[model samples]
Target: MVLELHVWGPAFSLPSIDPKCLAAIAYFSQAVPKDAWVLVASSDPSVSPTNELPALKNGPTWVSQFRNIVDYLRQYSDGAWDLDSNLNALETADNTAFSSFLESRAQPLIDLSLYVSSQNYWQCTSPAYGDLLQWPNQWLLPPRIHSAAKARTAHLGLSALDLDAMEDQRKRDHSAAVAAGKIPANFIQRPRDTVSKLLGRTSHQSQFRLEALTGELFEPLEAMLGGKDYLVTADRPTSLDCLATGYLALALVPELTFPWLRDAMKSKAHSLTAYTQRMRHKCYGTAAVKVADAYPSLSPSPSPSHLPWQTPERARLATVGYTLINSLADNTPILSSIRAQNRLRQAVESSKADLSDVEREALAKHATGMKKDVLVSVAAAVGGVVALLGYMVQTGFFSHEGEEEYEEEEEEYEEEPLEIEVGEAPDAFGVMGL
Candidate 1:
């Protein structure tokens, strides 16, 4: 019987961006026969019984949660690896407790880093989903996902710091740092510099919050992981390893939203990083390389291809229009300087004879007129793009008719499960407790 794992497209060299999906991938990577299992990178949530990715279709059985999938594989599959098979009842209870603890404690940080942190969400996390979706969805889904993530973070009280307050605090800190000669006064101001430094700062409340959470969760994991191959002192990989590897893999990535989290993971939970790397190597092996190339569609699609316009001709027109708008939106002084230089060069080249003062004045006037004409042309192009987009929207060119048909087909496949076993899904951040 074939096993199919439905998961989000791979990103950041992991099986999926969602830690739960990564955990499921890690667990089943060891359990199922390579030929028997198949991975489907899909964005549609309607196919799953629970409307989530990382759901598994094991022959006739459908399991949605990671733990439920693990249980199903263990019960029915031959040669399925079970790390807790030999553990005593006491150790089993400890493993279960630790797994729950780790999930509850670490999930929020992951959420904060990937979604709440603007740097990671915009630059890294959101773009990761681009290729998995088509037009409008490729453009539309990310903001929705970002909004949902922000809402979740706000609900968790991590986003309680008011934006204006944070900005004011950051400015004060930056000013202080410059005065103290800690940061060069002339250092190039990057968009990420302030946020990065703020998150990295030891004294910042956000940093302290992150560190406290890191210590609470990772310190115990580090203690348990001392000289052990796996989190649970098991000779083989277990469910805990799957969960640990997921968060650890994400935390260890240098491009994570919170660099402090990466720094903390490396400095405070160094052992876990090593453990994660080892687990990755042992389970994935050459599959990682294959994943990178074979799953090109898993990466973000090229920007030009996913425009919402109906025809290639219209998309091309829109691209030109947008380019003109971008050029017009540049700093006025910079654009003025550029225009002045170009006018000077053209005036010099166009002069076939020594010009009188009046000729020079006339040339200057013509150049000024040319600049106005250029601006008018740019404005017209922008207006054209807007009008084109409005027409497309009115005509329903962006409507995804095929998606409705696809969903209809999916509805037929949504059958009553041969076996139903639900387990508490691992929360990225477990409930706060020791």
Candidate 2:
């Protein structure tokens, strides 16, 4: 028998239970054959229709507890189901519990669909959810990089409030409460201490600063995902995959409102945030009703400028080049020789120490050549890095000395010849083992 798995979280916001919510349910329900058993699991008790547990009465069951859902699902589908072990898989640490759940749910008889509460459906589907599939090689993952580092227009806004402002506001609120005899000075300090202790911070200032930092970083995240449904191979979606989209809606709202949340995200951490925003735009049709690419509707649309992922093509090209250079250095031998020629040309152009006309022209020609070479190297690099970045993005490898090390290595490599094996290659006739 086939088993369908559904995941739902508690209701707290507009995204908690909505069209995407229903789509998640239906999407997963249809992934498996009709003959399979269906199981719905929700952190929220009211996820099922008529407010009843599907697991208790329906042929397909609804389970409020994650462990119970795992137990029931394991019975009907051994190799077909793919679920994260945690009650709320998306909420688990580093998504490890979720990863374990997916590995367990893999079987031949179960077909999985997801009804998730978060907006990370795009990620959960491919690269993320795809990691746990019985045959992940069969799936086509989306673009792993979210273009966070790509060039684009910078529109600064007061949307971000500084730490000083937050502190002053808190102080003002505290003073007002104390003056009104609503609470003593110690009352405010007590909660602050409690929070500090719980969070493992020594002082309220440190904890609050951390919050402010997180908020600052995630502020630009919403703009990263304009509108675009991140499909898991355009049509099929596995369980926990849809949560990638759901997690976005959950994260975006909070990131927009809370400055600290933004600050908490750093570098590639922004990629996850960016991915969520892009997925929401894909599924929900921008900030407003999405007019289908094939249809025309007079719905109130979101601003064309207020897009989620709008990094320009040229910028994307540059980033692709940068990532390529880095990855090639790690996995290939030709990378060093190629980077040297490119860097030599760059040095000639940037050097303002003065040069004769002959030297200048020679340098100019060489730089021009390097630019073309860099462009080509970058293009070839794009393919390799896509695989690397896709995995890193999904598994959370954006943070580390890896990126920095890559940059330094590239810089050193730029001093070498960009063409290592070219002179060593035989004629186009492919003659001998020279």
Worst 10 residues of 2 by lDDT: 108-117
Error of 2 at 284 (Å): 6.8
The best candidate by lDDT is 1
The models' CA-based lDDT, in order, is 0.66, 0.38
Model 2: per-residue Cα lDDT over 326-393, one tens digit each = 54573454566565666566546653324787987897787678667767878788888898889998
Candidate 2 stretches greater than 4 Å from native: 1-14, 17-57, 66-78, 81-95, 98-248, 254-259, 266-268, 278-434
Give per-residue lDDT, candidate 1, residue 258: 43
State the TM-score for model 1. Answer: 0.58
Across residues 1-434, which tens digit of lDDT does each residue of candidate 1 receive? 66778766567766567787778777767666566676766554445655567788766666777777777677775434565677778878878998888788888777777777766666777677775554534654576667766666675555422233466666888889999999999876545344655545533676567668789878999999888888776577778888888777777753654465787888887778788888876654534432233244434652221101111112245544543453454335546545664646565555333578787778777767767766777788789999999999999889997999899999988887699789988775665542
Candidate closest to the true structure, highest TM-score: 1
The TM-score values for the models, in the order shown, are 0.58, 0.27
